[model samples]
Target: MRVLIAPDKFAGTLTAVEAAQAMATGWLEQAPDDEVVTVPMSDGGPGFVDVLSAALGGELLAVTVTGSLGEPTPATVLLHEGTAYVETSQACGLDLVPPERRDPERATTYGVGELVAAALEAGARRLVLGLGGSGTNDAGAGLLAALGATAQPDGVLASGGAALAEVTALDLAPARARLAGVEILAASDVDNPLLGLRGATNVFGPQKGVAEERRVTLDAALERFADLADRSLADAKGAGAAGGLGYALSLLGGTRVPGIETISAAVGLPDRARAADLVLTGEGSFDFQSAGGKVVSGVASVAGEAIRPCLVLAGQVLVGIREMRTMGVESGYSLVDLVGRERALGAPRDSLVELARRVARTWSR
Candidate 1:
């Protein structure tokens, strides 16, 4: 029997590649006669560049840029066949900031702009930017500023979302000039707009430390920035991704593509699933949100299209078996369920290995 293993990053615990390796190790231990193939996955988040590089064997260009907290940060841009792939999380992801230091009110996307500038300087004619897992909520004001979009008095947009309310006017011509003729793909799975109830601040701000009371103020600041920038694109799909970096990309004429679809097609997941006897995919938590445009659902969909049996091996499985079937998964196994929560969190890789080994006993022939 042949098994194809694909999984996304386990949030803070393990990377996608690491998770795949752990699963493969345990599966092979239990079923030595079976063949296992690994294809790590991402949904336009932190591991976007790494996964793409693994698939495309691209040249990684290292660059230093401003981090979400206005500090120097290191990131990589994957250049392949004149197209550059940029992962937004490397520059401004929530993982970059410590929990005690997390401040969505002041975080910025300036590093993302610097990354794009570096990619352009490397002679990339087409840019594919993966957006997700950001820490900032500046509505991309800092990114625009880094890309040469200036305010009337200058330095008005220097700060993050907190300063957007003070902006009187914006000049986007310079940024447009820099990106002219560059085909940009804004990759993301989020569909929330830039502001309002279903928008960036109201929906994602809490996770990044935007208190309930401060959400309204921060959302209004984004509204002000949008008013000065382009209000029309503020309500566009994925505009809220990476804390409104999607909207800024729209202002620069970037086309939106679902992050999963972009990465899935690039990796040829459908064909791989078709060739496999069993398909395995997972994430940090397999909950209701897993059915959304996340990595697990994306992989399950591809397996379903190929008429293959898809199962999930996650750190924790919150959804019921019925919901798992609805998401195209035959069954779901949880690390937390096999081992206690303490061990699951302390030794995630080992816990997953044991869980996979146990599951293999029942599933593998």
Candidate 2:
């Protein structure tokens, strides 16, 4: 039997490559005779550059850039041909800020702009930015600022929705000239709009540490930014992703495309899974989001078309067997339930491997 293992990163626990290795080890221990192939995957959020770089050989270019907190940090971008892949999370990811200091109002994407500048300086003709895991709701104002674009100073130029109220002007001439010939692609997984209740501020503000009472203020701020940009936030799908970074990229001539679709096509996942008897996939949590165009769902869709049973192993499985069955997942397993939540949370890698081995043993029988 040919088994294909393709799983996303276990969020804060393990990377996609690490998860694939653990799964492969367990499968080999239990099903020694079965041919197992590992294909690490991401939703074009965090770890996108690393996963894509590994799958398609690329050179890693590291440059010094500012962090979300305005501190200087080293950020890496993947260079493939004339196109440079930049994962914004490397500069402004939520993980970089501590829980106590996790205020979206204070974070900035200036570092992301720096990354783009570095890529441009390196002679990259095109830029692919994975926009997710962001800690700010600046609507890419800070990013533009870093790229030499002018914006209203003072008040809140970096933080949550309230900051949008202070924006008095926008000057993109510098950025336009700097990136005149470069094509920018803003890869995102979410389809949230830019304004209103379902827009960037209202939908993602709380998660980024915006208080409930402050949501409306932030939402309105994003609305103003959208207006200033001469674009209707509500009309753009994925405009709310990365805290209105999608909208910012759109104004900057960046094309917004389904992250999973882009990654899947780049990695040739569908072609590989077509020849496999069983395709294994997973994520941090297998919930409704999995069905909403995540990597796992994307892989399952392809596997289903090829008539292959797609098995799943998650860190925590919220969806039951019946729910997952509808998405072409024949069977689902969870490390949290198998090893107990405490143990599973403590050492995810070992727990995941053991759970995979146990599942493989069951398959062998």
Local accuracy of candidate 1 as per-residue lDDT tens digits, 203-313 = 999998999998898899899889888899999999998888899999999988999999999899999999999999889999999877999999999999999999999
- Please write out the lDDT profile of model 2 over residues 136-204, one tens digit for every residue: 787887777777777676534454445678778877778777878789988888888888788877888
Q: lDDT at 248 for candidate 1?
A: 93
What are the TM-scores, per candidate, against the unseen true structure? 0.97, 0.94
Which runs of model 1 end up more than 4 angstroms from their true locations?
A: none
Candidate 1, residue 174: the lDDT equals 95
Pairs with backbone N, CA or C atoms under 3 Å apart (clashes), candidate 2: 105-159, 105-160, 161-218
Best by TM-score: 1
- Model 1 / residue 350 / CA error / Å: 1.6
